[model samples]
Target chain A: MTGRVIVITSGKGGVGKTTTSANIGTALAKAGYKVVLIDTDLGLRNLDLLLGLENRIVYTIVDVIEERCKLKQALVKDKKNPNLSLLAAAQTRDKTAVNAEQLKSICDTLKEENDFVLVDCPAGIEQGFQNAVAGASEAIVVTTPEMSAIRDADRIIGLLEAKEEITSYKLLLNRVRPSLIKSNEMMSVDDVVEILSCPLVGIIPEDTGIITSTNKGEPIVNDEAALAGKAYRNVAQRILGEEVPFLDLDEPKGFMAKIKNAFAKLKAKV
Target chain B: MEKGFVENGFIIDLSDAKNTTQLVFELSSVMEHPEVKRKNVCLKLGALDLKQSQLLSIKALIESMDANLAFIDTDSEQTEASAVSLGIIVSEISDNLEPSIVCSAAEEVKDEEVVIKTECEVVEEDKTVEVHADLNSNANPIETAEGIEDIYDEQSTQELSEIIPAEHFEANFEALAESEGLIKAEEASKYILLDTGDVLPEGAEENDTNTETLPTLYINQTLRSGQTVSYEGNILIIGDAHPGSEIVAGGDITVWGILGGIAHAGSLGNVTSKVRALKLNAIQLRIAGLYARRNDTLNVPYVQKTNEFTPEEAQIEDGKIVIYKKLRRD
Candidate 1:
């Protein structure tokens, strides 16, 4: 069964690209589909650390491209998920170590055995981004609810449009604070979706659990109690062509806000 | 009954050990203490008979912990033969050497000279005590339990140094200063060592060709991330090796500043080659074919600078990269 190649990227750094790749790949694996997560950010790879498989990465993608080891040997199996494995990038090498063709060939070879091959692209649209996007036919552009992140996402989407290999691309709005949006201090989800002019794949709310989970080397998706984890799982469901609705992140918090939210909902109905 | 106090040396009494495994376990557990990082260790092995390989592993285990196995106090004749073959100092603990050892099994393997233990216990210099007794049958046999107590009763610590053979110091490096007092570069990494390019290809045989005879390459500039310097011989850098940089040398690598990158020495498998730095904070320390990544707990994210630098050295011994914190220059 050939897998769909999806590159998870953000033009700006610190936009949760790696986290999105990790959580979505894990969510797919938990759904009983074999998934491969490839980290193409050489010299600054962190996908393995997020999955807690850093120690198990003996050989990296560079080893595969250099032919020092076979591609199968370099695939580090996730500690908890048997169906999910990672192709880690070499932390010591830069983007020039493995070019676009080599990564594309690796992704091509890996797709034959898995249901989804998710490429975690490094920030920027330079050689690293081109190399990451080379392996995949679809893309998920991760953007935070800020002007700078949206601007970068637009640049990434424009780049994706020029490449014929990227048949489709979707946007993932990350770190959306509902209270901030309610107070007009942050951008609303609809505003980002409208500005990017791209279809939405996921909207992950800002959760304190993400920090602890990242440090613990466990993905937030594994924690069922976490709101962000549930949101990521819904994102995975939507990726599987299921019509999962976006999470209602704008829940009222205090008693006064609850009364105001009820009036706003009624006003929307009216 | 581990009563052993020699200056910069520890006398471990493993007489309580029932078997070889337990002895090594207890020895390694005690070696974990900061005090045992670099010191001479004398083992008191009881009646358990150990083969040559087992004895070698025990020696390697001690050496891996940065301690040298100075000698073994054994009761088994087979053990004594194994120790002698391995060039390990085989000493018969005098019945009344230290006021600490209270055992009956020790007096059985007495040698001609009651020299080793007396000197090891009294030497004031750190791990400089070397007592060499010529392998001779215990000429004077005493069947009575208390018969040998009076032979060395009057022998003081100063007079015991007289019997230390002068030739033994250079005879063997079985238990010497080279490996003693080393802090282990603690890493639980896999054994696989990766090569970047044609740089030290895999499955190569180890040749301990002296590194001093090889040519040297010196760089006075700082190495940033992704930059690499590989040399056929020794490589000397006067500046810091940043976190992502790599330094590969056929022989030795000496960095005058912080080494926060990966430093591989004896890259082609010269086990004697070493990696030294003013501050050895390398992400990974590799020697010969061995590699040790810094434990994540000690892995700091950013490069730190300070005026005071406690230089450290890493070298391969007993198939492990043991780091040594060098003495400060006043």
Candidate 2:
């Protein structure tokens, strides 16, 4: 079956683009789809590290493009999920080594064998970002609620529109703090969506479990107890054309606990 | 060569015409047709290789017969230019040529009607008005200075000489000013006013004196952050100007929606220009040489409260950009 190539990009750095790509790839693989994740960050390759497949990467995307190795030989298979594999970026090479046409040809060949190919894009609207988005038919922009991140996301969306190959795009609001949003201190999901004006793929709340999972080089989606893990699974299901309701971040535990907490606060006020 | 009769014209194809004599013979055959002579039918010349002089002679022959003619299917630019130089209207060289000529002729008729209506009104107001056939021509000499006495009897002249309304005169003056590019239109009022001191209407002098209407650029979508729009003229946005988006205009800026970005209106140092917005939450604003940042302590006038937000306008006051509510004009 032919796979759909999707790129996960955030114009601003440190906004969980790699994490979102890793988790979505893993979640799709867990759902029994053959998925391949390519880290197009070039010198700053980090998708393999996020997937815990860093040790297995003997060859990289540059090796395939430069004819140093076969495309299959460069793919590093994940330890946990046999269906999930990664084509890591070359840590020594720069972004200019691979052009859009080369990556597009590689993605075309990879789509013949895998069900999904997710490219983890590099930050900034530079050569690296162009290389990452060159092969994808769809884009998922990751951004935080901050002004700077939203501004960069806007610019990236404009660039993506200019890239005629990417026909559809969605936004993934990462690291959302529902408490701060409720207190009117931070931008809400609606505010971010209104400004960005893109369809929402998923909203992953600010979870500490994401940090622990990153330390272990394991995507948080593997943990059933993690809220962010569940969110990524929901995103994967949505990508599979399933209508999954968004997770209510304010009541992460249970609806009963949320009501009881509200009563307690009202009692204290009285 | 093929000669055929079509509706309202005859199509004489001179694709095989090898000499100027053959070309003239083909044009003469089409012009001599009874259908073409009975009415002022358009003779469409097709694929002719005639020289400029030959074409001009053929056009003169067609006009001598009182039949309208046009070079309708010419591929040569030289032929088209020759026809235009000879004052012969060249219909578009396309498959459906008749409708294009008809459409342009209809437009000319409409323009002439407007000119006639304006001239008629001017004549009725003042019999001294001299009507020019071509309003766009710069050489509009007065045809006659004979007053209302020449056109009407004494009784009718008295009725027609009743005071012309000021509004109609102003419209006529504006039209004249636009065509003449004169500053006299603004001064025309001072000469017409009785010596009694009455304040001129608020916007009347302003419109006349400001002859150069500033160009305006319109943005109908939200300007997101990181997007900077710099215009050499005034800017009008129908959507929100989000934070981090910068708009620099050389003239006044008007935002129909919320303005939260950095706006520099009148950037070329025109201090009288202002920036108006429905909600002025701008991070920084500059009008001309004056600058203003969003401050919590500055108390400005005319802050109107809406349902949820307060709409504010900013203008240069006392050499600084000050935020105020939009004053109701009425």
Candidate 2 has a TM-score of 0.44
lDDT of 1 by residue, B225-306 (tens): 7688997778877678987678999888888789988788998888888888878877677787776666655545455665
lDDT of 1: 0.77
Q: Write the per-residue lDDT of candidate 1 for residues A1-270, one digit (tens) a residue.
A: 899999999999998999999999999999999999999999898887688766456578999898988899889888788999999999878899989999899999999999999999999999999999998999999999999999999999999999999999999999999989989999898888888789999999999999888877789999999999999999999999999989998776579989997998899999
Q: Write the per-residue lDDT of candidate 2 for residues A97-154, one digit (tens) a residue.
A: 9998899899999999999999999999988888888889999999999999999999
Best by lDDT: 1
TM-score of each: 0.60, 0.44
By summed lDDT, which 10 consecutive residues of candidate 1 chain B come out lowest? B139-148
Candidate 2: clashing pairs of residues: B302-B325
Error of 1 at B57 (Å): 60
